[model samples]
Target: MLYVKIHELRKRKFKVAQIAKELKVSRPTVYKYLDMTFDEAKAYTEQPLGKKRKLDPYKDWILAWLEEYPHLSSAQIHDWLLERYPDLVVGGSTVRTYVKDIREVYQIEKKVMIRQYEAVPEQPMGKQLQVDWGETKQKTTDNKEIKLYFIAFVLAHSRQKYMEWQARPFTTRDAIRCHEHAFQFYGGRTEEIVYDQDHLIAVSENAGQLLLTTEFQHYVNEREFNVHLCRKADPESKGMIENVVKYIKGNFADSRVFSDIEDWNSRALQWLQRTGNHQVHQTTKKRPAEVFLLEKQHLQPVSSLLSYESTHNQSITRNVSKDNTIRYKSNRYSVPLGTYQTMSENLVWIEVKDEDQKTLVIRREAKGEVIAEHLVSSEKGKLIQNRHHTRDRSKGVEELKQRLVSCFEDQGQAAAYLDEISQRYPRYRRDQFAIIYKIIQQYPAFIDTVLTKCMAEKLYHANDFRDIAHHLHTLRDEPIEEGQPFYTSSPKHSHIKASTRSLLAYTSILGGRA
Candidate 1:
């Protein structure tokens, strides 16, 4: 404006001094502006509105980045400058201004990304409910940051939401509690509950086969609700609850001062009534709580609340001894052998199998698989055990080996050969010993010959020993005629005939003829 006004005043024949005083400027500034031509003045005005900045050296680089990634923010560009040029000396604000100026000069627009979502078919009322868990950090009233974990539930058709927060991470038991609370709030549950493959719910889902944790599996069975676990990394499958989780974290949890967990949960409930369930959803264009009114009639009535006190706490931890026995009220009850292999501390659960408390049951740590169930004995200091739990003493491998060696004429040689076979097949050494013992008993007469042949041929494998023994036994049992080959010989070559000659003539046909 000053440059154009200087020219305009001069064209009106105003003196340079008068123009300077009228424009409220110094004489040097007015003289500098008066020297510019109209074209030069227009070019000066066209230039980007900023003085030479400290980031002039990186103007081209910044312009290239903005062109390639239009979504890049000023703070991101500032970080890039520090990373690309470690010795860079500039403040964040300076880089921000320079990036802004470059963007405006080049007309490079920073575009916002909009995720495209297809319209999913509306789920049947009371047929589907999406469940998800999320955690966020919120500063409490005392200005201390606390991370709170929460689980969110949303009815698919109505989008009605229910959420609960906890100070610590939620376990399967806690998740069950949250589920009961949600059921009580909604007055019912959906026929099928959709969820991410959360650890609290499922342990793994491979090839569409979902393996629910034991406690969760039992709860699902008890509630009689069909479960549909979503594929990993597929939030769109259960997007309604996912969005509710985000809404709770952003609208309810963000900038909201946390107090005790009870207060936080109370606050969350109030928010659900105020804005969460009450607000008109952007997609449905109807309030969730209002729509749920009609959908609630379709829900299945809550069967029974599996209270925390009723289940999962009746079993007591007991240490499993090396002999696979657990000490109970007064006796040592036996479990199956190898039960101690999986327990880190040899700890297992001993629960009363029946409500009458007449049957005692021992189970695994988490799977609740019953290991043994026995009739409770009233007498003290008695060993209550199952006959099947005993390790068989008659079929011990060492006993078989010792008995087999006693049968052979050269017991020392037999013991040494068996040792070599055991070493060669250590993984199945016991199995090999049993199989060899069976074959030896089958052909007691061929034992000397078979053992001798095996020793000579180094046939230490049980299959090889069996083959040789069977061959010799076959000859003794079913003998062929004298001078007869066991297998028929190939047919003579009668088609290509040669004249018969004496055996001595063969030598004459050789070099002996020379």
Candidate 2:
């Protein structure tokens, strides 16, 4: 009816609105159905005798072409067939499905079977978690080669998965830390965690008596989590997480470009909630997020004031250089001058992040006064002599002047040298000077002497401290009167006379008298 209206309107040169009114239909209806309603002139008439061509003759050639170019589409195959088999009577649409069927029959195409998975009857929510690592090649901004490992953890009952990347090489520490992070991420702990017999956490590969790394076992027991090793060569024991590993690699890692591991994980986690978690599980026919939300209620509550060492722990020992600087990474970090008076030796806990293996040392003060503390790395540098001070928005230079005064309060004459540095480098703020103060604290005994020497030599840059320290070492050990050195009477002379006057003097002074 719409086509008839359009045809009539076209014949009479009428507008579509007039045609729609005449046809008792909306203008859009008339326009939408116009093409379908309009009749097209036939190009040929039906004939009793028509030519028929069978494609069976070209079947061998088609099969050979398909074998050579397995990925070629049906239209491409049709064109190629038309070039040689002009008499072939196969439509492109039909040819495509035929080729697809042939590939399937030959097992050339990958087959995905959706098999039902039966949940273990004894397994309960918050009972078990599976852990695995996924790795892929990556390049950093500095063109450094790196392999990115995504640590994936999934709860058995909820199927709630957590994935994050490791910065450092995979080790026992990394595996244990991954579990700790996953527990904290989920906001609770699981009763048991399943694992593959990977060397990172697994100590030995005895089938029945699998031995987990001591460190890993300790972490689990401390957290009240049990360890369950999956059967070797059988991923089905922890099959849920194997599927998760594949999903994260394909859906998260493959679809994104990342400059850093954190950025990659952030995007992956965003997609995890936005896409993966919300989607219905293939076998369970239930959304994982919904199920996980329900399972979270069953999770064991974390105890208040739980005492545990950091998962990423490293030891820091106190050492004050003769020049009064705390040594770390062969570089010096400063503390207050009188800090040594409070304690002879101090143990510091350093949290080493696996992603970059970067260290963060915690500092605590007993009083309100600013004391010696280790400065954290802000950038890549061996020594940062200059202190870091935030810009004073209100008092401005006055605040800096006060900081300089504080440094002077700690070191009397050394204050003049710091004042000179502040005068020379306007950009050097109080915080930067505080770093110097920290250095002073670490090496209080020698800090004053070193500062005096540095100022006398007009050494301002922090990097110059290394050279000055080396020069000071030379001066301190300047070989007292060479040839007549302490060992001069050694060789057979000392054995010949045990009570010689020179030997007696040396023995009394050196406290080596027998």
Candidate 3:
């Protein structure tokens, strides 16, 4: 009937657009049927719905993947194909269409068991905030892939949101810091902050006893806000934030090309302004920015004295020791090399995080740029050091050892002396070489004599060599110069009451007892 109507309309001199409007059909449809005879239309209607082509090669495996994992998304399937066969040349749309058809043919359905939910009344302004963590993969400019983690916060009343991203998984201190940043973005916080059972914040849910991590617990107490942890596996209780997580991943991050985390988040703010916050919400029928204007008036004021803002953070000062470490709770944590300017009162602030005190964060200033972070030691007086911190010292020790070996005339004696010192005092080799290097610089020729004496007597201690060199230097009244050959000829000083202590005394004394 429609094909005959197109013929009659064309005979009546009806324009394509006009005919399409009158018959409520498309202009292209009118043209297609207008040019077709009865026999041609019959053949067109009887054509096959689908045809085999390029994707037929992968049809079997694609069908198998869908049959095995019904929950796999088209994007995930595309990723898997690329991962399994790196040289597979296929577009995402091509795979999507193929997967859809394969699913229908194999009767593979993605089953979802929906739970019943009660209608939740809209929260009033400043009443509550829902927070959740999300992550996504993005392509860098160089076409390399990187995964980024983020924490998102949404106001329960207005749906105004804030987000922060980092390349690494968040620690407890990091989570608290992001919370403060979100609170500032929203101008203040709600009366209650909602969370899921994130291991970063909560230690355990012991029969309903919420044991929050110690760092976050301190922050909650100091910030004076209530915490609401959603029941495990029940995301519908905080469904608003869960939707926000999906919305962010799908709408913003999926289309973005990431250069770095800072740039990714910086541009996300513009997206929020241009689309996320400005668009009229489906439920509220108002822009989030406009609703937030009214909601900001109800938010609680943030405290500069207590909150961990960019300007101020409540951190305890610890003096930097000569070894470039700070002591906290009987353990020493290292800072970057050269962090210690002087031995006396050079300070860095330290904070212990997690309920078990598992982590330590150290900063150059109170809440300033982080210089070091470490796992807190369980044993007292343990040194928790970052290997990179002592890399320079390692290099310097190598150079010093080379220079000391060159200073000796008998190379065999010099190598043997060094080998014995290193093997005997492995941990203190650097300090030993440091003292020996100084003594060699002061009395060049005299050190050779000490080396020969130490080799014959098998004495490998550096301080003893230093004292013997000084004693010989005083005996000879000649001032030692750089290029002048130094020697001690007093035969009476050949083993003149050189003070010595048993090597076992060093290890026994270090056992923390007399």
Candidate 4:
């Protein structure tokens, strides 16, 4: 307005310098304003009026109708408005413009992102891998409800995924088992595997220093694979595996039914290779399997180092009956019968692997003598005693040595105890010595005690310590004799009833008189 005022004044022959001074605008600007026609001046003042959607009657109806029928199109609104106002004139374009303005107020349309582009070089294939756990519901043949866990591993660049499902809980064992199977499935292991800090593999500092389970460490060390854990709450760290899980859920496992976990997993693997791995990645424009093969080419071969194999070690305990037989798990196995010598203590050692809980056996612990063998029946009526058979008494001691060796096999220094003992006692064939060893087995504390006693007595022979132990047992259980009474039994045959001196001593000593 100030510029226009000055311009109008200038056109009426007012001096430009004077108009500039009055309007507080520059002289050039006043001249520029003066150059404009009446229509231009009107256009400048009318700009706001042209652009603004006025709160007039027709605009009011449009706003009200929009609140009620938000989905109505601009044309629909235009037609509705035309019906109401015969005098009010507007074009489709005007109505469209108003619809856009209303949308901005309501914030309904999808946002447009203007990305500043930067080129990211493709990552080296197999340089990184991703892992995650997925779950699907299943039912057994008998309609038993169950949920199965699948560990998903995917190559980041290729998106080639391997899935392994287990019927059991996602324990540390299951995790390692899955990894081992996945590596075997790929014919090799990747250089680096990214994990989501899954509780089975890694825990937080707050929880304690993140410690991988021994089984998991064994797998990683054996395979020579580097494990990288994603920072907590950072799902994008293993985004490839996460995406694979989503893809599987949507394309394959979603709403799918299976007989059991194994069945579900078999179908999942098939689907992954056929449907998921073969699909073209939206961004990479390459099939996952193609990229995966390229990744495999770049990967270091599965280390020539020992491959991690699944190990299922279980411990079994058995009771030693009066006959020195250790009924472990369910089978009756015997140590040296000398185990029964010690009445107060009883324990036997056995190592078991991959045996059914109900039918596990305890053969003689010694090598040569299958001293006693017992077959365990799954039935309830089976008598453990009926199954026992003694192979040879002469080999019983050797069996005990074998048993002891087997007991300490998993331990370090203890494993060498038998080997060293065997070397020292060459005369005591492992079988003969096993008898004395059975005593040590029955009384493990006696290993040191008998050893010390034997050394102290210079008793190199097993029979010598056996004799000494028997003597100690006898003395320990000896009965007291009541024959000898000692109390000055020169019992006064002479002064039978009335010696004052004797009476006083007796009274003082025994609180009584003769």
Candidate 5:
């Protein structure tokens, strides 16, 4: 307006000094405006009104940083600039101001549009419930940092909410367990549950169609409840539960000391009962607990849905390896040796039950025969073998014992002795049976004597029987006369044999040297 008035006064042939006084402006300003065309004056007025700052030199660099890391804060960028340029010293506030201007100039900063969602007509009590999960990191009383994940459920009408926290991320089984707990907390279930596109439940989405994970699909089928998966990146569809997740992190988890997962969960439950549910909800303007009382009657009875027992019985199929083992949850479990011996597929059914201590029950799907049960391990890459599954060594011992009994059947006492020794020394029964079989093969006549001596000496070892048989053979080799006394020493004989005559003949032949 000043420039237009100055130009018009000049067009009326007013002097620069007079125009300056009339417009209450300086002569230099009036003359400066009067020198410009109308278009140039308008363009000059439309220029950015702020003055240049020291950071004007690094505007491109700041924009580049923002483009690379949009989540970087202004303070972080200021620190980065100090590190990049050793001589550059700038205040954090100055950097922040410059970054704000740069972001506006380039339109690089994320602009969060406040979306207005049309108020959905109120759902009937127990008709719909929204579920979601949120995560945050916190420090415990001991100053140990831990990440916490929480699952929250909110009834659409009454705004009744249920929430539980865990120290680790959730799996499909955990999600299902949370759902079961939420339903039990409400004393019933809703007709349909709304959820975001979480990988634990929603596997994939195509043209607004969702395919649920296998375990979640089975859980929903058993429970007989409809599942509503919100569109991708859209939280407003399940905004109630989303808000509950935030409320839990802000209210229940903030500055909370986590001694342990179980204790923390217990306290979280108490918090929900005392503070979360009892407080007047912001939207409904009624206490959620009070509203839940009226909503409870309309919900599907807990007993009417699938039993909790079946909902938690998650079953999967695993192929048995050549080592008679099956892999489950990164661990290997053994079955009987012949369980998968001849099968073409070598597949077995594994049913996992979520308990205080989780357990895996493996069964032969073909015959519905349970082969093994084991406590599930949290550690990865472990091999858990059942000792009873490898009984082949014991069966071999039994076969050896039967052979030993059949080999010595002719002599009752010998056979009984063999059986006794075999049964007594089961660990070495195969060796004992082999020794007995060898004796029967080599010393068929001395079997009874060897057995008798062995039993009398209380010698049950295989080498003991072999020594006894060898001694008997030595006695048989040197026989003694019955009537004559055995010679105790060398006997002296007066009458010599023909060796004396041979010595005299040799002397005569040596030229009568006698």
Candidate 6:
């Protein structure tokens, strides 16, 4: 219409400036329309003015790189191009837009979509809770980027949700802890929980059957709750929790400042109580907290579920070392010596009852036999031993001490030495006594001498006793000349000859009288 008006005005001898002012268009637009025929102006309006892009020359390279590394971000691709072709200069946003277009054109496989399923109707109140994990990168107050992982649980009927965040990924133990807290927050637990095949809970799926992780399976059995695993890659199956994850990211996490994980979690709890659960849910149009009151009665009583103590019961398999010890939480706990007679053949299942106290109950995995129990040590690189596990070895040491004492008429000193050694090196008493026993066996005559030297030097170690024994043996074995007096006393030798002559004369006198 504007073009026709312009043509009619131009034929009427109207100035291009007047047409531009009347139409509120640029003078150049008016003049261009004035120059074109009516049909030509319409055709020109239909065609788009294609502008060339700076990245046009590198389209082929970008597309090829995307085809090879589809996961690379635009910034990463930009850096790669700059390195590959130093003369290339392109903005990151341009590469991002171009990469997106190339992906659409080539039909690149960005993500493999699983089979879709329709939404399932809501179950009875407290009948099911959908659980999932979501991760987001957050910047700390110090301007450091940290990844936060959240475990989200949403009631299927009430749409009530519970979430917890941590700076680290959730292990099986952490998952269980989060579940317990969620249940406690709701004042109860649902009869079943729906999961999206989380590796932390579900290990694998075969023929539509879910194989839960051992820890999760035990937890389910203990809590008396059923589990429903969603089909692989099927988020819609447990979409309630997925939405909760998104809602948290958009509403609570955006532009939030938290000092640390604990602070964030505390704030998150307050957010759930004050805003998240109290707000009218989009789908249900009812406050989740309000609906949860009705659902809470349907949920299993908090007291009926397993206690927090039972939920955290952890059974970890550990290889027993040759010294009858197993490492746990950076400390060593002793097991029975027979527990690992063959290398790599024995694995003990350490059931930790109290982590704070470092108390553990150990069992032989192969035979299901309870071998030993120990109070775990808090200090790292320290060994906590149970003397009962080495009772036989202790008995052998007792026998050696008795034999050494019997070798002396004055056994008081020897008994005192053994007692002192047992007290000084309580854990290694057997080893220390064994060294003493070796010294006694090698030089029975020098046993007292070695003990005296050990007491003088305060050497309670086994090697010290061995060294003293070697020195004593060397001294006792020194050669002596036949003419030299063994006692270095001439008066004692002359008295010894006179007594021998008197004894012979007395025997002759008695024979002659008979």
For model 5, the superposed segments whose C-alpha errors exceed 4 Å read 1-116, 304-514
Task: Give the Cα-based TM-score of candidate 1 against the true structure.
Answer: 0.42
Query: Candidate 6: misplaced stretches above 4 Å?
Result: 1-119, 304-514
Q: Lowest summed-lDDT stretch of 10 residues in model 3?
A: 44-53
lDDT of 4 by residue, 7-123 (tens): 568668889788766655557656655776767756744441235554234655766777776677889888887788666678789788766655433333424445464544566
Tens digits of per-residue lDDT for model 3 on 155-180? 98998878888885665667887887
Worst 10 residues of 1 by lDDT: 479-488
TM-score of each: 0.42, 0.39, 0.43, 0.39, 0.45, 0.43
How does residue 126 of candidate 1 score in lDDT? 93
The candidate that wins on lDDT is 1
Q: Put down candidate 1 lDDT per residue, 320-345, tens digits, no spaces.
A: 88888887767889999888876365
Task: Tell me which residue pairs clash in candidate 4.
Answer: 365-399, 365-403, 366-398, 366-399, 397-434, 398-431
| Cα lDDT listed for each candidate | 0.82, 0.61, 0.80, 0.61, 0.77, 0.77
Give the worst 10-residue stretch by lDDT in candidate 5: 480-489
lDDT of 6 by residue, 312-356 (tens): 545656778888898876788888767777634566777767656
- For TM-score, candidate 5 versus 6, the one ahead is 5
How close to the true structure is residue 439 of candidate 3, measured as C-alpha lDDT?
Answer: 94
Candidate 4 residues lying further than 4 Å off, grouped into runs, are: 1-122, 139-144, 205-211, 303-514
